[model samples]
Target: MTEMENKAVGYTVQQGVATITMQSAPVNALSRAVRVGLIDGIESALSDDSVSAIVITSSLALFSGGADISEFSGGDLSPNLPEVLDKIENATKPVVAVLPGPAFGGGLEVALACHHRITFAGNQVGLPEVNLGILPGAGGTQRLPRLADPATALTMIVTGKPTSVVKLPGVFDKISDKPEHLLEDTKQYLASLNAENCIKRTSDITLTMSEEVQGVFDAVTAQTKKAARGFFAPLKCIEAVKGAYTLAFEDGLKHEGKLFMECMNTPQARAQQHFFFAERAAGHVSDFDKSTPERSIEKVAVIGAGTMGGGIAMNFANAGIPVTMLELKQEALDKGLALIRKNYENSAKKGKLTQEQVETRMALLSGTTTYDDLADVDLVIEAVFEKMEVKKTVFTTLDKVCKPGAILASNTSTLDVNEIAACTSRPQDVIGLHFFSPANVMKLLEVVKAEDTSADVIKTCMKLAKRIKKVAVLVGVCFGFVGNRMIEPYGREANRLLLEGASPEQVDRVLTQFGMPMGPFTMGDMAGLDIGYYVRQSRQAFISHDPTYGAVADRLVEKDRNGLKTGRGAYLYEAGSRVPIPDPEVLEIAKQEAARLGVTQRDDISDEEILVRCLYTLINEGACILEEGIAAKSSDIDVIYVYGYGFPVYRGGPMQYADEVGLGEIVDKLSTYAERLGDYGKMWLQPSDLLIKLAQERSSFAKFKN
Candidate 1:
């Protein structure tokens, strides 16, 4: 027996079989070193007469995360993934790939290249390159369809979601029932394969072209166009798969490579990849050390049993943490509990949760009308109204009732966490867990770090957010923290655009076309215009200087047009329908409001101007947030917008979008808009000094420090 080793890979030969082990810890990324080692190990196995069969497996927990995305941004390295995989496929002896766990992206591509594949039944595999704005570049698109039916192959590649290897027919030659016996299973399967049972290369499998197959391609093309709007990779993924039916094996591989590069070269891909790293980066606390401790949260309590409070409690319940939902009255408690049950029941209906699972989560949630019931709770989150005084009152009571060392959290979106912490005796234990609307559904949780909040509490909440499955972003205490602070200017500009002559639909169309899930006005109407109307009222001192800041919205709310609740808002909703229909009365209201404010309502507004005015201002405010240290990094802001607000994922977050549009270009546009609108634009859309400095230095937000 002989053994060989490399930095990220290992090779050993025994019993006439050679094994290649990927040992890169924390998801074996197919990096340059790994690639080099694979080529070396395979070449040695092929030349050695002692070895008849080669097996590729990982020494790590999983097969691999994917291709090293960090490598994608840099220059090409020797022995790229395609060349390595090709070497494995062209080997004279049978090469078997074993997966103990999941294989995604290039990892699955590597396995597909092997002559035979074996995995545990529980293991999953996918070609999720489309998620990073690229199709499978390493012969995946061509090979997957050759092995699996084209429809199954198309769905897996296009959606970029993992599937069980057993579900993908012909992809895995053997599926082991139990994971503990993976080694034994692999050995048995290898022994069973005779010369007659030797499998052909995946690329050698022919896919017959037919009208029905073409229909599957056409239907997926239409579906991908609708589902993956403004995205470059999904459609390219479909095109690459289509080549499998039209082109031969070698030609299809070349076609796949062409489409992969085309998608990789797009700004959309750059943005998606940036977000992929940014979301992971959002969890790290820059100043925290390895020694930083995190507290355990066992029992939980939530104040207020309304929609927000109920949703907040559901998160803990879903995480298997017992929660006591406290309300001022029993009736409110019963109502909140019922609503929570209804939510669980609805999810059970969708098969997202089983009937037993729904009951289990519901049983974890208990309701009470007394603060005394929260005395033993490990953490208490105040999910009451947005008003500061209301939050203060809740915290003051929590400071008295909760056990010492218990973490107290506020579910406030925009109010100051610092001031809320001041209400409690143990300010260090008080942090803001600002969950978005429909808290159970929304992925973003702004972990607001107050000035007096201790590091342990911050770390503790961040870890807890992960337990509940959230994209937690640590942000400093401020008026609106990270997400909402930047959105103020966004909503302000969108409103001001109405006065300057852009209709509701026109502004919405421009923004939605630019990749936002919805424009500000439509979002405002859906969230209830009265909510913003009240938020404005509470912050009147902040916006008192500008009379026309939200005059149109204020007037609408004053006219009893709260939103869909009243079947009227910026646009009147037809009875029982949430669709926004243009109302002449709303336009008349805009005209009157504009005239009253002494502002001109000109129709010269173009879609480009509207896009710049709304997005660029939002970007400028993000720069301000970065400078203030409200957000530790630009990526944190992007994480908030992408997850909390429906800022388009393809566009990345606002900061990533700005970098793609060019920071210098953004600065220039802000200046131009300031000159065009004079005082109004200068007041609202002024670029921050940090933004100016980065632009002048020809730098991007991604590269900017401080």
Candidate 2:
């Protein structure tokens, strides 16, 4: 027996079989050292007379996550991934890969290059580089189609989702029942293969461009174009897959390389990459490090049984935690539970959940009408009405009912969390978990840290957000918090545009074309016009300074146009449909309001002006959010907008989009708009101090440190 161990790769030869194991822990990314180790191990195994076969596997659980993303900016590292894969493919000795877990991106490419692949039952594999806004650059696009059917391969690549090895029967030569016996099973399978069954190279396999192949490409292209609108990489992935059938193996690799570089150079790719990093950065809390202790959150209770409260309860139940949903009356509790079950049933009908799984999730939920029932729960989140007095009443009750050290949280989007905490004797226990509408589905959870919120509570909620599959961004206590706070100006500008003679459809079209999920007016229509009307009415003292603020929406509510529920709002909706149709009546109302307010209407408001006025105002508010330390970083605000508010991912939220637009240019545009619009614009368009300083210094929001 012979054994060799190095930093990145370990080599051993036993019983005529040489084994190469990647030693990098926690997703063995192919770094420079790992690449050199792979090359040397292959060379050594090939040269050794006693070694008849080479078995490659990972010392850790996963084969690899992909290339070292940190090295992406380093440019041209030695022994690039393609070269390392080529060395494996060209080797004369039988090369076998045993996958115990997921083989993603370049790792899947490496498995394809090997003569045979053996996997454990639960092992998964995929080429998910398209999610990062680039096609696979290391022969994955070419080789995957050769191993799997073209349609299957295209689905995996374009969606960037992993599939289990068991579902893909022929992809691997052998599947082990137990991961512990994977190596032994792999060795036995290798021993069974003679010269005739060994050394099957993927490159030599030819793929015919059948009618079905064309159908697959056409369908996927149409779907990707519609689903991933304003995004560039999904379409590029489809093109690279087509090259596998049309071009020879080597030519396909070269074509894929060209397409990869094309995707890498796009602004969308840079934006998506920034978004990926920003998501990871958002989880970090400056005051709470990894060493910070977290309170246990095994049992959870959610106050209120309305949409928001029921949705919050479902989040915990989905995570397999038992939940007690609290409401004022038994009828309300029964209705909420019924809605939860109906939601799960709908999911089952849509194939998102199995009938059995639906029952299992529902079985985790229970309802209560008394606060005493929540006394033992580790965490209690109040998702009652948005009013401060109502929030104070709930927190005050929770302070008396909940056990010491139990977390008390509010789901208030705009109310001050500090004031809510003040009502509780244990202020440190009171925090804000501002989940977006439909808490079970939306990804963002604004973790609002009130003035006296404990570090332990902050640490626990951040970790709990991950457990519930939500992206928790730590934020300071303020009216509207991070996302809603910034959106105030965005919605204000949309309203102002209406008063200035831009139709709701025109305003919606410009912003949607600019890549927002929906225009502000359409979003208001869907969310119910009265929701914002009531919020504005509650803040009348602060907003009374500006008469025109939210006037268009107020006019809609004054006319009893509630939104989609009423079938008439900013835009009209037909019965049983959510589609927004431009209403002449709404336009007439806007004109009447404008005439009453004595505001001049312009017929020539270009799409550019509409896009700039709305997005720039949103960006300006984000800068103020950052300057006040309400958000730890500009990226946190970006995360909140992207995940919570339906901001475009390809644009990387408003702050990143602002940086791309150039802070200096944004400042100049704000100055121009402020001067152009007079009093209303001056109140809304005045750039924050941080924005002015960054623009003057030619810096970006990305460079602003909290």
**360-382 per-residue lDDT for model 1 (tens digits):** 99999998888898899988988
- Which residue pairs show backbone clashes in model 2? none
Model 1 collision count: 0
Clashes of each: 0, 0
- CA lDDT for candidate 2: 0.89
After the best TM-score superposition of candidate 2, give how far the Cα of residue 429 lies from its true spot, in angstroms. Answer: 0.9
lDDT of model 2 at position 403: 95
The estimated TM-scores of all candidates read 0.98, 0.98
